[model samples]
Target: MPKFIVSLQSNADYEAAKQDIEKQGGSIVDDSMKILGMITVQMSDQSASSLKSLNSGIISVEPDQEVTIQVA
Candidate 1:
């Protein structure tokens, strides 16, 4: 299985993104956020469609704050 590291801005983003990713067979291995408004999550997936969809809505997704997700 492949792994992905997705970063989200807020709790809502994390939750929504988590749900979406889970639908694509992503297993969240870990997650963390900082006071400066940064969230890091480790996930695993075999497809990219879910991530692509999630990213497409990121701008209007309304996370807690300005955040960045680095998919690894």
Candidate 2:
């Protein structure tokens, strides 16, 4: 399974989004960013795509990646 960051519309229903994700076989990983209208989820690529297409409240579903900074 891959992790993705799901961004929701400002007026989107949070509960509805969660239900949509679960219906697509995805699980919410981190919702700490919900205040910012973002959620981290883990699911298959197909599920991710389905969620994106089926859920109108969702703005974008992007891969979750780590960023590192080096001090010189």
TM-score of each predicted structure versus truth: 0.47, 0.88
Collision count of model 1: 0
Residues 1-72 of candidate 2: C-alpha lDDT, one tens digit per residue: 899999999999998998899888999999999999998999998888777787559999999999899999
* CA lDDT of each prediction against the hidden true structure: 0.47, 0.90
Give the alpha carbon lDDT tens digit for every residue of 1-72 in model 1: 544445444544556666776676656555554333333333343354346556523322122335689999
Best by lDDT: 2
Question: RMSD, model 1, all Cα superposed?
Answer: 9.0
Give the count of colliding residue pairs in each prediction.
Answer: 0, 0
Please give the lDDT score at residue 41 for candidate 1: 32
